[model samples]
Target: MLTKTVHSSTDAYTNFTRKEWASLAYQASVSLTDEERTQLQGINETVSPDEVEEIYVPLTELLYMHTKHSVNLHNDQNRFFHRETKKVPFVIGIAGSVSVGKSTTARLIQALISRWPNHPKVDLVTTDGFLYPNHVLEERGLMKRKGFPESYDIRKLIRFLSDIKSGRKSTEAPMYSHLTYDVLKERTQHVEEPDVVIVEGINVLQVNKKDRRISPVFVSDFFDFSIYVDAEEENIIKWYVDRFKVLQNTAFQDPNSFFHRYRHLSKSEAEDVALSIWKTINGVNLEKNIRPTRHRADLILTKGEGHRVEQVEVKKS
Candidate 1:
């Protein structure tokens, strides 16, 4: 595989400015409606039709090509072996720091890619389900390190991915509730073998296999493609704080909300708490864990102020 940086010698990626990338959207085959976009938008984030047309449409087209190539590769191998096997799911991994909008990215990608005519069954899941239950985190005294890699059940996450990649007809994953801020006991999401499976999380692209002690296998080992959402650290801090403020008025206000106590905080008090969480937890995790995985991604979306992707960088195949 050849590699080259566009118009640059030092960078590893072929950089594409927003407009240059948007030009390729003339080939966009999926047609999304405004209501669908609204459903996919994240809290305290902006995702406009222009952003989808310019960024995601072309990105989806790329994923479709990859999926097709994978199917053909399997067919070719089977011909040589004189045996047939079922088609495996084409997995996509999405990773980024919290509040960077990776969730929105995953949802938008799933919606767009499922519109493809050939194999439209696309299922999306997040690694949050693989996080250790709140009780376990508390027992281990890891409550403050909630989103850190060590907080997840890596073995279970790998098992789930293995089943999907192996073309299992049906698999079940535990579901987590934000209101309860914990994994549900009796609730599970069923996943049927699909043409594409999207796994999104903060530490999704972390190079976990380098340390064998970490896990025998990584969840990303099965990914056909990976994307990393990126933004300046300060910008993410601001977004996180802003999102906290919004949740205070909504989810946090519910009496049953895990954070209900925070709902009545004065505006100044809320800002203080938000900043504390960012500086002590999220910011530290980003610097020590999530940000280190950025270069591992095949494609990177660099978001600017207002969460609009200002530039894209793609690794050469």
Candidate 2:
């Protein structure tokens, strides 16, 4: 096993301002090029280069180190195996509440890590593909709880991850349609062997349940490292409201969108609807299912009111 202290004693987890945290992040072990820094400049409206350096740079460094160690471990284990066996992919999981910017983080990390000299091939897959078809959700009366753990095909997701980690030559994941808010039957995405594979979702770290017995092997079991994006509940609620309005005027306006009706609501009416959905659905799911997994993450990114990452909590191993 590789042993080294990962966190610094002077690292501030909760006391630093966003800019101060960002400065410390840039000083971490990871190196970022000027071109990459320029590319990161476009992260949403709230995230900045400083925040990326402070929050995501440290995260990417930790993950890269863990992945390197995992590769070494796998190579050692394979010493007794035949030469025909393929190398296993390094798996990472990212979890967070809705509107907390976990998707952006996942995408950003995938971009950054793939550019690393030691790991040139990286791929990203999301658990949204494992969500139950819209018709099934409607039949089960779970349309309002779309992000809940029960809304996903947990067994299929586990099996898919298992196959990918087993060094399968190719694996297929179902495609989810934002326009229909459901899984597309005829559509699938193929994943080949990669140096790194990031699986992201609201509940990617949740344990599996089979009838009355809890399975020991969870989705997180496949992860070499995991991260959780966190922000205050009030701030997340505000973000949900703002994003819902933007989608209402844009994607929701598409005739085939599952939320097409929302596009017709007045601005104030839409805000009210958005807040209600956040409170009744997303907010409750975050509290009951998502937040509990925070402690399981190898690292945590805490965001401030401005939506920039203000603190990083890394578990000392």
Evaluated against the true structure, the overall lDDT of model 1 is: 0.87
Candidate 1 residues lying further than 4 Å off, grouped into runs, are: 1-10, 209-213
Question: Tens digit of lDDT per residue, candidate 2, span 1-317?
Answer: 21321323234334445565456544355556656655544223455565566767766766767877876776777785745455688888999998888877887898778767675688888899999998899999989889898888887888999998889978999888878888989989899877788899998977755334435668998888888888888878778888888889889999999899898899999999998888799988987899878878877877777777766777677
Pairs that collide in candidate 2 are none
Kindly list the per-residue Cα lDDT of model 1 for residues 109-224, writing each as its tens digit: 99988777774788899999899999999999999999988888887888888889878899988788999899889999999868888999997887664346765566768899
Top candidate on TM-score is 1
Query: What lDDT score goes with residue 256 in model 2?
Result: 93
TM-score of each: 0.94, 0.86
Worst window of 10 by summed lDDT in candidate 2: 1-10
